[model samples]
Target: MTKKIFASIVTICGISVMAVMLLITALLNGKTADSAAGHVRNESRLIASAVEKGGSDYLYHTDFDKDMRVTWIDSGGKVRFDSHKDADSLENHADREEVAAALKTGEGSSSRYSETIMKKTVNYAVRLSDGSVIRVSGVHSSFTAQLLKLINPILLILAAAALFSALAASMVSRNIVKPINDIDLEHPDAQKSYKELAPLLEKLRTQNSKVSRQMDEIQSRREQFSLMTESMTEGLIIADPKLMVLACNTAALKLLGAGDFHKGQSIYSLNNSDIFRRCLLNALGGRRSECILRTGGGQREVIASPANSIDMVCGLVVFIMDVTEKQELETMRREFTSNVSHELKTPLTTIYGTADMLASGMVQSDDVAQFGENIRGEAERLINLINDIISLSKLDEDSAPRENENVELFALAEEILDRLKLSAEEKNITVSLTGENVSMPGSRTILSEVLYNLCDNAIKYNVSGGRLDVKIAHAPQRAIITVADTGIGIPKQHIGRIFERFYRVDKSRSRKIKGTGLGLSIVKHGIMYHNGTVRVDSEADKGTVFTIELPIEKKNNEQGEII
Candidate 1:
């Protein structure tokens, strides 16, 4: 601002001074020319008077200045006398503008440039009373010559003026800019500056307030975003188009096994896996990408989505999810479906074959009864398989009854044993229920199912004359039930997966026993529904003991206890 003001002031001064100088020079030149012309007219009139008084002797005797010329012409247009040149050698004066006008008028004057002398000649002619003309001409420097003569002095004056203008411009510009520079931008309204700047200062105040509010709002939103991302179970990462990490959550760092992550570092610095790099690159290319990365922790699903603005990708928002559990669940679901199909097909096929034989009369009258019995038995197996599937589905989807009721473990065990009395008798197993009645809050139906399945499995796997014991007791914050049977015990290798749906320890033996393989699975799910735990202790050719513990309260009493 100071420099601009200084330049403007200097330019205006220089131009103004030059214009004034030119005007003065022109005015002086014009005045000097007029004065010289007047002198010529007066001199010509005086000369004409003297020539009229003394005739040709006055012009011949008189001496004039070296720059001045005198001539006398007769009415016949002939130069009769010349002061500077011979009268006979001079040209006819009647053809001259001043002389011709003087011949008709009383007096005339004219000016012309004389290239020979490089000066302007001013001529004045007067008609003499003797019927002749007397002319006097004076030569003076031209306007160009006068200006040239003044050039050195003009230059000296301009130099002095420039120096003065420089000083004045400096002082003036400083004064003009000082107030503006002194104003406090943070408190513009408090400054006593120029009244002309009041509006600008007010606007500055308004803009400051607006900017302050916007900054606060942005900070608030940033905090909220940070909170949300930090609290997420899924890992989240934000990166620029250059693949530089802008933000990363704790979950992301843990999921990707990236320790002590810092922002603005390359994302590859976190995990330089091929799949990670490929997904990010695809997002930068404006395409949404997803890939699974197997880290030490587990399988992580990385989803990179481009953040777009105006048809152009600006950055990337990446989500990393620990899909290890989800993938395993999906695998289990598929296996369950296949197993259910296989289990149902066998029964349906058996029933279909037996019924078809009976319907087509292929079986003899005596064998028809056996065929009908086979069909009925297969249909019953199909119905039991379907029921078990429905129960397992309900448990998987948490769609079972949630209402709890007080259930006595001892009484429930006795009831289950009574229901399986016929099966126990078929195996020649002696069943006994003992121990005090341990009461707990639970879903009655699920507990009953749990007790019934454990008792039924005991009888089915028992040897002839085996012993079955159902005992109920109490432990700290728990109601305990133990079901022990002298049966072909489960092998150690199969104990872990015995609770899985349709998992049979001995397939052929289980087929002959004629029981759905979902009994232990149902018992496991029912125990889980009551927030209880079940343990199996077994050895081949010996006996297996099933111990179940149900929480007395709805919630577990132990801290950090994993069921």
Candidate 2:
């Protein structure tokens, strides 16, 4: 701004100076031209007097004028004599313009000018008593020649004038602009300005006060808006009708996989998804639109709603809500219900069939015992499945706190192994116990259930003459229980779902295994109830290992209650 002011001042000053110079030059040139023409008129009148008295003899006797040309024309319109050239060689002067004008007007003067180079030639003529005409002419370079001759000096003068003008303009501009630049913006009222600016400064002071108040209010609102946006979990974005981003929260930025962006940039710079584009277009068209967007961050439901004012769409307010966890919970609930129904109905159906046969006396005496055994087996399976289901429900609900007790983990494992030794014998597998008698504080029932399930699975899946190993060890602050068996291990793809209720690794061998598929799931929930962690290691046709870890003491049992 300062440079612009200074340059404008210098330009105006330069133009003014050049105009004055040109005007003075023009006046001087006009005066000089008039003065020269007057001198030539006087000289011509004296020459005419001499030619009139001396007749034809005067032209031959008089000395030639060196600076000008004079010619004597005969009355027959031919040049009879000339001072500057041979008389016979010259063209007829009676036909000349000056001569023709003189013959008609008695005396005549004419001047011809060339503006291109600023040159002029003046001619004066008189009619003598004879039929011939007396003419006098002067030739000199135009004013432009004089100007060109003085061009170097004139340019020097102009350069000096421009320099002086520029310096003056610079100083003047400083005087004009200093007060404004020196104003203390933080305390605008303290400005010391000129009298002419008093009204402006007073108005400025009033306006400054209003502006300050407006800024404070805007800042306060901005802070409140920022707090509201940051406090929310759902993502929010505001956009103009052109789909240019006006504002967005941090959640929206993260959801769209975007970094810091400025306002008024097209939203396509953030996401070029066709569905998102359609939603934006629809919303801007005054129609609310929604889309499910999936990205690396998970699924989000994007809703675009138009903001309306005065019966017209003004902008769009988009809300992006994360629904990944909610969707997964819904799906799990559905699967759990279906699996529970199927698992319970299978056992109940078997028991009902057997009991119905027995009550009708359809079975012979010899087969009655087998039928009763079959009913009893199905009944036990049903009861065990029901118990497992109840325990799982309690864990999920985080119900009443269970009594915590200190139990020797190695002794508990040994007892469980002793009970499972017969099953191990039937499978022709060797059972062994290794590691220290690590004691941990937990619910005895849940911990024992966890250990028994692992050991039972190990024995059940063991190959003929395979080995079962139960290890209880102590870590820095944890009790580690590992039950490993050399058996047909789980497939890698099914390892992730092995702890899901009723999930079986091999459906064809499931019936031969002779146990509910809910065993591993029960192990998971029981161990989870005691504030412990469990991990599995397995290989196909090799073996499976279930490693359970319990804290030596309850470490911020955030799980709330143990069922």
Identify the candidate with maximal TM-score: 1
Model 2 TM-score on a 0 to 1 scale: 0.61
| lDDT tens digits, residue span 62-108, model 2 | 89667677777766678877778898997776767777888888777
Candidate 1 residue spans exceeding 4 A from truth: 1-4, 38-64, 95-108, 114-118, 125-134, 181-186, 210-330, 352-380, 397-404, 417-436, 458-471, 482-496, 505-513, 535-547, 555-563
How many steric overlaps are in each model, in order? 0, 0
Q: Which candidate number has the best lDDT?
A: 1
Write candidate 1's Cα lDDT for 1-563 as tens digits: 99999999889888888888888888888999998998888888888888778878877788887778998889988988877888898777778999889989878888999766567999999998877888899987887778888899888888888899999999999998989999988879645899999999999999989999999999999999999999999999888878888998899999999887689999898899888888899898999999999999989999999999998898999999999999888888898888889989998999888888878888899888788888889899999989988898887677887866888778777778888989888878999998997888878888888888888888888899999998998889988888999999989998888887778888878878887788888888777787777888999999899998878977742221112
- Which segments of candidate 2 are over 4 A away from where they belong? 1-191, 194-203, 206-210, 213-217, 220-233, 258-262, 277-290, 308-310, 359-361, 400-402, 418-422, 558-563
**Model 1 C-alpha lDDT versus the unseen true structure:** 0.86
